[model samples]
Target chain A: MKAVLEIFQNVHMALYAIVFILSLIKYPVYKNTSLKFLPLIFLLTLVAESMGMFINKVYESPNSVIYNIYYFFYFTFFFYLFMKVINVKKYKNYIKIGIVIFWLFYLRDLFFTDIFNESFIESYIVGAGLLIYCIILYYISILQSSKVLVIKNDLLFWISVGLFLFYIGYLPIKIIRSWFYKENSFFWILLIIQFSLVIVMYLCFLTGFLWMKKKS
Target chain B: MDEKEIIIIAAIAIPISLVIIVIVLFSVFARRKNRMLQEQEEAKKVFDRELAESQIEIREETLRNISWELHDNIGQLMTLAKIQAQMAQEKPEMMTEVSETIGTGIDELRALSKLINPEALKSLSLKEAVSLEIERFNRLKFIEAKLTINGSVMPIEANTQIILFRILQEFFSNTIKHSKASTLKVVLNYSEEELSITAEDNGVGFDKSDDFLGIGLKNMKTRAQLINSTLRIDSEEGKGTALTLKYKFV
Candidate 1:
């Protein structure tokens, strides 16, 4: 069980690298201006996850600091991508305001609340923000677009669904992590669920990258 | 299981279920939206095809009118001028009548030239086009036609004007061929947001149940719908026929 769980964790990192490589291959073919940063996002995720793993496993060090740094990078790239895809001029101001508020809370948590450890509150805040963004993306994809005749093949639609499912699936685990830590059986079960959700999310990304057509 | 474990299990189950539900809902919603958009595109394509067909029909109808006018009106006028010219050579006092006949033929040729030019047909406004039709009717002595403009004239889309003119042309053709109408009146009312046109003929109109209003009326209604306009036709036995069209500017 331990060996399988370790393989699952490593596979998640490998999936990120695969996604990055796929984006690189697709970069020259798909000429969407909004998708220029796709490979960059996957590259950042791969580096962040590998570094976090190295610091925890090989160096025997706390990796919360790496995660703290990575969370900022992840949110920034995703926020920009969503803003570009949503393409609503009026909502840009609201997104800017949301980013400001999220950073203020994140910085406060980094300095004061859990300076040396992981801050579940900060993770929860970012998760909630991303969940709302995904919902808004879905709303715009459905209501604002009449030209897209095949929504199933739409890249943004799949990305939004992946984000929505992952956040919703992981949010409960994040909230109840402390309780699960003291219960061995519950911890394993929740771990399995969390890993499964991550796998599904990465699969959704792969599907989106593979199925998306070149913008005309 | 303890209470915390059960609560955790329920919490996990609820969100997973919610995720599944949302994904399914999005798929259904997207399919519905896509189908609606496709239907709209199909409708627009049909409208475009119909509009193109109507334009061709208008051109053909104009050509047919030109052919008849050349053979009947202009041909007869030229023959009369030739006869008068020959007479003037024999009798000097007949020169004035010969010159008058030639001048009248020149005027008829000028009017026919305007109708023959495709650019002129496309460039003319609804009012100008209707005026030309009325002038043709009066010159041919087919009917007494009058056109009245009620309000300030507003520029309309050229394609829309052509379609409307063609519809009125069809009505005039039917009135002259079947109605035995002596008088025809057309009114154009241009309001701030809407343009209204009414054409009424004092002739022997058929009953509402008559099959005479078949393809012609359907074509007119379809053309009006293509321009987002409304058309109404009223007729009764022995009463005159009236056609009203109201179009709103977006």
Candidate 2:
């Protein structure tokens, strides 16, 4: 069982490395301003994720400060990367507001959670916020699909659906973990589901990226 | 990373890598295909341009044919009528009737020749040509027309003068045929930077929201485009219509 889990982790790392490398080469070809920002954000997230994974392996408890810092950076970079890819003008102000709110929430959680009396539900609250944010991004992506002239309808639909499924995948990991305190079995299964979702999201973006060239 | 991690990562990595590769291939293929399509579009545009030029040539040929017919056939008939009127004066009884008939025929022939080609415009600039047109319009029974030249005549290409004359004729015919108008004003303004013309009439205007494509108006627009001029129109229902043309110097 350990061997199986280790194999999955290696595969994930290898995939990330290749994706990171290819995106670096592909960045120059995308002249669109929004798309041009994507590869840099992805590279930043990739490095953060790599460092987080290493920290996760070295530490036994979830209380490692280095692990938490890497984790924060990882999620932040991922959010920024997703924001770069979605081409919608209406959400411009909304994204700024969301980042401010998220930053406030993050700072509040960091300062208030351990020093003051805090509940175990704090992590779950963060997860819920992230889930809600992803839902809004998915909605924005759907709305923007019409305005983005270069993307095909079907591919846009798939990307929106992938985002929705990713949000859904987070729910089981967030709600069930806090409420039920299930065994490690649930954790592994949730991770696998989330990994599957990442694959789906990548595929949808790949489709959208390829569809752009034919649009004009 | 250990063997267990390797296997699990392969499970996720394989599919993702495959999707990425497929996407790259599709992008390359689509770019090549779009290049071919762009070439085809360029070829089609060239073909259409050639076709449009041919059509314009055909129209010019038709106009040339009508011009010769007026100059040759109608001009000869007018000369014969004038000679017959002079011969009728030799007798007293039939001279009045024949002379009157010949005089009316000569006037109709002269008008027909002017419609075919405004030869009076050949020696004049655009402003002078427009003034000649206004003088002819005033001679008609029912037209209350005015011509105004606001500035000194600028030197213009003779070809441009011909195009402007045809455009003015089209406007007059449109007012006569469609616009139930009593007064028409033709204004010409010349400056170093641009040449401008304004033709306005108090008329029963039609609804403009609906697509109204008049052939004469379309021809005038094409002529304007050929000379890099802008044409603008302002009209209201039951009010009036104004046409303006401004030519860019550079």
Candidate 3:
């Protein structure tokens, strides 16, 4: 079971390398906008995910604050980039509101309750929130398509779907936690699924960047 | 909070924030770059237009200088030859030959000089110039050109005369070059309101309505624009062409 997890992890790592190289080549050519930024965000996310694996296994790194920092940057950049591409200038106030709400929820999780001790519930809630935001982002992406004055493509759609699926995939780990608790095999399966999803999302983002640059 | 809960929360928060920040910065940068490109394109267009205007101005200046040189130098030489030939009329045979030869030579020189210079257009008047041009054209065997002036010649400014003469020459040159027409007609008319010149050729006509511009036509249009005159060409492939030039003579 560990071997299978290791294989999946290796594949994810290889995919991450491929995506990083593709993105580095892409960003210089593309230069600006949501499309260019998406790839860099993907690269950073991949790095964070790898670092996360290292800390989990070897360092037992004190829940490295750096991991949380990376995650914070990743989500904010992704959401804002998507919004800019869509040019939801009117909905900008909504974004500020959303950010505030997110911060509120985050602080509530960190300081207020023993709720974080409930691993299943905590995973489920976090996954669900991201899932909801992903859905909102997808809807924004759709609304953006209608009156686009600039580059358009199906790649963003695919990336959004990858994110949605990863969110859905995350739900199972929470739902079946009782059955898989303290089971290294189950944890391995969950990690493989999640990491595979990360690879898929990165590829999708890379594809989007390429399409935009080619059009330009 | 337990490790699992903390990790889960962090995962969601971190990725989202990072992506948004990068995108905003990138967008601002892109917009700045795009603006620079647009400004560069505008500058190029302005430069190109200025170059074209300068070229046209230089050509007009050269033509004016050549016209003045022909009249002042060549005209004087022809006059002197005619006077010297008249004095040599003492011997009967020599007088006839010299007189006839000198007269023909004088006519030829005047014609050549007219070809070189559009002539003192203001002194000749538009009507007289049209008459002279038609007479010249009538002498050619293959094509017949007719002129009609309907109103008394109005005194126009010297600058306007030179500009107008060049425009007429440009039109006639095009007709001779492109139109294998048998007949050409020019009409100069004035009313209480405006002065108008219409030249029509029953030669190979061109469709002037086309959006695509030919160089000759573009040159004609530019000349018309320079003088603030309205010029129109009506033509078809085989039918013929009629060009009208009109301006308010204030």
Q: Pick the candidate with the highest lDDT.
A: 1
Which tens-of-lDDT digit does each residue in B1-250 have in candidate 1? 8846665775669466867768786677767787788888998888778768878887887888889898899899999989998988999899899889889888989989977798877788989989988988998888999999998999888777878888888888889888888999999999999999999999999887877768998998898998899999898767789999999987
Write candidate 3's Cα lDDT for B97-139 as tens digits.
5556567656766665665453354367656656765665565
- What C-alpha lDDT, on a 0 to 100 scale, does residue A106 get in candidate 1? 75
Evaluate all candidate structures by whole-model CA lDDT and list the values in order. Answer: 0.78, 0.60, 0.61
Least accurate stretch of 10 residues (summed lDDT) in model 2 chain B?
Answer: B2-11
Measured with C-alpha atoms, the lDDT of residue B17 in candidate 2 is 52
Which of the CAPRI classes, incorrect, acceptable, medium or high, describes model 1? Answer: incorrect
How would you encode candidate 2's per-residue C-alpha lDDT over B1-250 as one tens digit per residue?
A: 6534543554455455546744764474456556656765876675456346534543464376456545665566667766766777786566666666667667766765665464543466667666655765675444688988777777777665566666666676677668888899988887888889899989886677845436667777876766668887778878877889997666
**Rank list by TM-score:** 1, 2, 3
Per-residue alpha-carbon lDDT of candidate 1 for residues A1-216, written as tens digits (9 for 90 to 100)? 788789889889888888889889878765556768778777888887888889888988777776777677777666666666665676665666666776777777767766446644665466466656645754665666663565666666666667767777777677667444565455666677778778888888889888877655
lDDT of 2 by residue, A1-216 (tens): 567667766766665666566656655556454445556645665676676677567854343354345445645554564566556755545555666666677677687666223333454356446645754674546443433233344333344444545544554444544554445543565466556666666666555444544223
- Cα displacement (angstroms), candidate 2, residue A194, comes to 2.6
Q: How does chain B score by TM in each prediction?
A: 0.90, 0.56, 0.55
Write model 3 residue lDDT over A65-115, tens digit each, in one string.
Answer: 445456456656655655565545655555555556555565565564443
- Better candidate number, 2 or 3, judged by lDDT: 3
Q: What clash count does candidate 2 reach?
A: 16
What global local distance difference test value does model 3 have?
Answer: 0.61
Q: How close is chain A of candidate 3 to the true chain A, as a TM-score?
A: 0.72
Off by over 4 Å in 3: A60-66, A112-155, A172-180, A184-192, A214-216, B1-250
